[model samples]
Target: MRIKIKKESCTGCRLCEQICTIWHYKEINPKKAAIAIEPHFPEPGIFEPKLCVQCGICAKECPVDAIHLEGEAYVLHADECTNCGICVEACPIDVLYTHADVPTPLKCDLCLKCTEVCNTGALTVVRRSD
Candidate 1:
């Protein structure tokens, strides 16, 4: 499934980010979460919940074929990755992030946990036909 973000509806409550990090890493750190709620100041109520849109560009550009589509989200196979950082450069929207502790980049895996806790309806899971 793909996640649809309604940026305007975001309240910056950060429930999505919290749940994401907890589910993936068993922590409460938002920085390591796949989803990020960024604030755009001087723009009134603009909080963009940045995430993977599952465009498949990262998977297509990976030289080692480390990345693949899990429904509409991209899933990285850590063993196949070469740490070339090619996929990071290849992502058109730049949602992929690297952490100091993790070998591979962090991104949404479509666990649906974030969408389940999104109180503002900013995040929604969208299932595709293919």
Candidate 2:
């Protein structure tokens, strides 16, 4: 499955981030959430929810090579990662966020939890055709 976000529909509610963090980590911290909504400041009243393009830069740049493509998604082996920040620098969209307290980075797994709760219909999951 894959998620496609309609940027125009996002209301800056940030409910996607909240639900993601809660579902994945059982917490309310937005910083830990895989998805991020960065406001377009100076333009006022505009928000952009960053979507993971599923690009492999993070996996490709891992110094320990800890991030691996497993079963259609990049899964990070936190234990194996040396936290060299190479992947963080490689992400073109800046979706990868450094966990303030943890050595590992956080990103979307295309789990679709955000899709289920998005009342705006901004998020969607579709099967990838082989």
Candidate 3:
């Protein structure tokens, strides 16, 4: 599964980020969330919601084999990660990020928790074809 972002529909309210953080970390921290909303202020203001597309780029770039595909979701093996930051660099959309408190990388797990709280329908889960 992967998340489809509607950039024009996003209002910069950060509902998706909030829900993601709360669901995964049990907190209200936006920095810990898997999804990010980048805002372009002044002149033409736009809210760009960036998220993982589950393209497996990170998994293929992992030198330590820390990233793997489990079913349709690409997950990170924290214990095996070397904090190389290769996954973060490998992400084409720049959605993968390093944990603030940990040395490991973090990406969207396609849990669909964020989509549940997104009132604007800016975030939607796309199921795998297979």
Candidate 4:
């Protein structure tokens, strides 16, 4: 699974962030969500979803070797992770945001919650074309 974001369509309303946090953690806080919408202030209007590119930085930086490829997805074995924050530092896009209430890193599952709730059709999930 993969995520696709249309930057041109996002409005910075952050409804995507609201639904993401609620869907994953039963919370309304955007800060707790794995997905992030960054505002490009003073640029008229531009909101871009900082998407997880499924790069293996988290797996590589995991000192405990807890992160691994499971099918097409990168999963964290919660029991094995030490929450060292190494993965967070390793990510080039900084998409590996930490869970607010947990020490472990959070990754996008590509489950389509963001896509389903995108009123602007800005986010999409697809089978990897490759």
Candidate 5:
């Protein structure tokens, strides 16, 4: 299943990001989180959650074939990754991210851990994984 993001409903609490980061990395670092929270300030003051929708563009664009679809989410094999950043650039949704600590491009795996802690219904797991 994929974690559907309702950007307009996001409260900018960053709970999803924190949970995802702690679940995967055992730390409370937003920079290491696969999910991201972006804010639109000034007039409309809303937050946008950047999550993996399993578009598969990152997998198709991987030159080393290191990326693949695993239960509808893009899974990057870090051992096979060359850190070329091609797939990161290929992401249309701009959810794929690169960090100094990570050699492979990181994207959400639809683990649903973030959804468990979300109270605002901003993040939810949908049946569609394809």
Candidate 6:
């Protein structure tokens, strides 16, 4: 499953980011969240929500073979990661981010936790045939 974001409905609340961090890390840190909200000022009420589309670009570009496809999701092997930032650069949508407190790169595993907390219906998970 991949997340579909309705950019117009987003409020830049960061609730999705907060829920993701709390669900995965058991902490309240937005920096650790897999999803990110990029605010667009001067445009007035425009927020871009970046999320993983499960494209597998990061997996294919991992020189160390740290990223692998598991079923429909891409899983990261942190032990094999070299902090090369290759995956981060390989992401077309700029969804992948380097971990703040670790050497491994952080990408969404399509856990759907962020969708649960999205009150504005801005985020939803959809299954892809490919």
Most TM-score-accurate candidate? 5
What does candidate 2's lDDT look like per residue over 50-112, in tens digits? 977688888878778898886667877877988888888999989888778767888677778
Best by lDDT: 6
Question: Estimated TM-score per prediction?
Answer: 0.89, 0.89, 0.90, 0.88, 0.92, 0.91
Clashing pairs in 5: none
List, residue by residue over 1-130, the lDDT tens digit for candidate 4: 7777889899888877888779877877888777899988786568888978777778888888998887777777778988888888988998988865867777776556888888887887777873
Tens-digit lDDT track for model 1 on 75-105? 8888888888888898888888887877888
Q: In lDDT terms, how accurate is model 1?
A: 0.83
> Where does candidate 1 stray beyond 4 Å?
none
**TM-score winner between candidates 1 and 5:** 5
> Per-model C-alpha lDDT, please?
0.83, 0.81, 0.83, 0.80, 0.84, 0.85
Off by over 4 Å in 6: none
What global local distance difference test value does model 4 have?
0.80
Please count the clashing residue pairs in each candidate, in the order shown: 0, 0, 0, 0, 0, 0
Candidate 2 ranges with C-alpha deviation above 4 Å: 41-44
TM-score of 6: 0.91
Candidate 5: residue 118 lDDT (0-100): 88
TM-score of 4: 0.88
Between candidates 3 and 5, the one scoring higher on lDDT is 5
- Candidate 3 — worst ten consecutive residues by lDDT sum? 121-130
Least accurate stretch of 10 residues (summed lDDT) in model 6? 97-106
Q: List the residue pairs that clash in candidate 6.
A: none
Look at candidate 4 and tell me the lDDT of residue 86. Answer: 88
Question: What lDDT tens digits, residue by residue, belong to model 3 across residues 3-107?
Answer: 778888889998888888788778878788888889998847988888888888899999998888998889887789898888898888898976668577767
User: Local error of candidate 1 at 109, Å?
Assistant: 1.1
lDDT of 6 by residue, 1-130 (tens): 6788899989999999899878877988889888889999976759989888889889999998988898788988888888899889989999987666856777788888888889998998777742
